[model samples]
Target chain A: MNDKKWIVLGLILFVGLFSFPFWFNVGKAAPAPEVVLTEQAKAAKECVMPTDFMKTEHMQLLDVWRLKVVRDGVSQFVNADGKEFDMSLSNTCLDCHSNKAEFCDRCHNYASVNPYCWDCHIDNPKGDK
Target chain B: MNKFYMSSLLAIFALALIAWVGAPALPWLFGIVLPYLAVAVFVVGFVRRVMGWSRSAVPFAIPTTGGQQRSLPWIKQAKFDNPSSKTGVFVRMALEILTFRSLFRNTRMKMNEGNRLSYHLEIFLWLGALAFHYAFLVTLLRHMRFFLEPVPGAIQMLEAVDGFFRLEILYDSVQFGLPGVYMSGLVLLAAAAYLFLRRLFIANMRYISLPSDYFPLLLIMGIAFTGILMRYFTKVDIAAIKQLAMGLVTFQPSIPAAISPVFYIHLFFVSVLLAYFPFSKLMHLGGIFLSPTRNMLANTREVRHVNPWNYPVKVHTYEAYENEFREKMVEAGLPVDKMPESAPEEMTEEEKE
Candidate 1:
């Protein structure tokens, strides 16, 4: 073959690049992150939304809550089951799922997501509020 | 639309539908079996295609020189454009690949009103192409976060840069809590769409365009659309998606329940694209490196290039011709190197050996 060395070099590059994920993760089967729910969360029996909805749509719901609170000044959220709760993350959501590292950061770190919620809202609010 | 584009569009839809419809019942097939198969086909087929190209010998140095070639030392030479040396050729190839130097220089010839000719520089094609390719590359690299355990800092940094202009406010109408929109994905989709429109609206381009040309474009658009939809509109359990991605990479494939069918559709389009890569124009990825016209050194004048396929042929030398025609030359009173066996005494200089 013409330019045998160059062809071989290119093939090596192609194979190496495409097969990267395999060798990079070889023997390193990092399991999916498990978010730890607090005792308060467990006792409550359910979140504002269902577990499935919360798992997938929590970010959007939280965003809406923020918008509603800040923009429209509406603080109360009425869930589908006609139960009213405060539309605040630190007050309502964290009131139950308290440990941000255990509950929020685990999945966020696993998914490599850096949600800016921590930039403003404290992970663990103190006793007063 | 042309039948070719329609067929390609229909094909993508069919594949997406198959994954969406078949995923619940055959998660193993969509999530595991097909992905592996697609990768296998892509790798093996790509190698085979490259090998086939290698086997076909390029008998000449046919680099398309775009500037003054190497000649007299006093004459200015365009070293990179009309490269006569290996290093010059390397620089030329690098510039051609990285910055698309040739496409930047692309001009379309136009017949003037007065029977004259003119050339207009076509820069948008180059811009669109550059945008399309770079965005695609960034998007592909960003996806490494999913496959790699302990996702690399580089990818995370890239994601940050790509999503620097956070449009969280715009996403409120759609389901909330979505990550800021990454520019790479949007740019890729927009660029691909622009290229598609260029093919459709431009008269010359439309005339030259074939089904093969439109298939990849439509397929890519479908992939991008599904990807964007999954990220923002029909949000999937990303953590679950990441888990599946990690599992696939680590050879421990398992599908989490209740994951959106949109994910499956996206995966299916990608799988089809991968499987179709080598067989389509996408092989330009490899073909560009081996292209004789682009990759060769423009040194045909300075250096001799022997044709490898040349074979020995019987030939009559000048000596043999002179010897045969010696007697006739002497009789015709012409100069002769040698005397014939029976010749005139005055004409005879030497006996025939």
Candidate 2:
């Protein structure tokens, strides 16, 4: 009985440590970030990519669009719907969705993504945050 | 015995590294498909193996007792080595699993000048094995940042603690920025090397060691080496790797182009190891818990252990034996439990009937 005391203590510790992740998570996770769409997105009739594709694979698509437009000097993108549009982010995409807070930042923050597009291309150039 | 482990290990690593270098042509297969397949196999195979072990029933109190059993109340019993109750059994099993207590008690035999063989404490194998397993666990926990979005707070704290002791305290409090140096990876590699060299160099151990014994060590070493190389030498794109790892867990796996070729080699080795783990001695990771000899209590003195398969067996009864050997027994003047019938009595039987 005396020697068995350590077993009880060890068991308590084992269960405690293994379950720490779950216990620590209790009443503690951040609530999901919300996406808010404004009139800027509502007024734009179409986007360079389809809406669903943009929703899921927008990062990869943006990566490819960045490489081609910046490096290869290919500024025009033909959508699957056979509509050609300028592939410039600052001039074409931001032209319609100028409010970064209403559009880009919402979904990006929700997904916890840090897109490098803003590193070189400023989201706001009028000395604004 | 043939010293083939090192060459085979190097060949496998070099070939895998070459394949990774050539992976750009078919990035999807090596990067996306194999990791998913390996993880799937690891989960299903591990569960199946454990379930298979559970199906067998232990019908005997066959624990390997190394100490005194529970007897007279006056005599002290070894509660752990020869456990008499479930609690003692639990403690023994916990010690065996957590600290490899049995292995820690390992001894080596050495022939003395007087031709007398003596036993010496062999702590290196135990120490190396312990260090290897513990460091591997820490490294694995530290890798959670790659697989989770934003990473969990506990994992972050663990990573910070691990980095704090990453041989950084001795370097004048200088912190290695971005991806700092990790001691766990290096310690795992060193421990594995010690285990490997011990088997390879020792004559008796080398003679007894088989290809199967060396295979897992080599495979694990290859994994650690490649992982370290990618971390310190080639310098993989950390963001791309996180994206890839997160994607796999999310069931939306995608290969990031910015990821280096070295990372692919690391992934390839890991996949091979995972797929091979179920059938290899690596299954010992799960078997330590299931072993009846380690898990069972020595309670035979306090309780009866009836064999479930016990059944009636044919044997000659004493009455039948006496009846058949009555003449021989009487001739030999041997006393029997029952008396044999006399000849005169048999002759009078006709008149009596």
TM-score of chain B in each prediction: 0.88, 0.83
lDDT of each: 0.86, 0.70
lDDT of 1: 0.86
Please write out the lDDT profile of model 2 over residues B85-200, one tens digit for every residue.
88999899999989999999999889999999999998989999899999989988877666555556677677666667533211223322224467788898999888889989
**Top of the candidates by DockQ:** 1
Can you list the residue pairs that collide in candidate 2?
none
TM-score of each: 0.91, 0.66
| Model 1 chain B weakest lDDT span, ten residues long | B168-177
True contacts kept of 1: 0.74
* Quality of candidate 1 docking, DockQ: 0.68
RMSD of each: 3.6, 11.2
lDDT (10s digit) by residue, model 1, range B133-215: 99999999999988998989999999999989887653344442266788889899999999999998898898898878988
Prediction-by-prediction clash tally: 3, 0
Please write out the lDDT profile of model 2 over residues A9-114, one tens digit for every residue: 4445644653343344454333333445446667775677766545544554555566677678887888888988787777776776777885787545433344
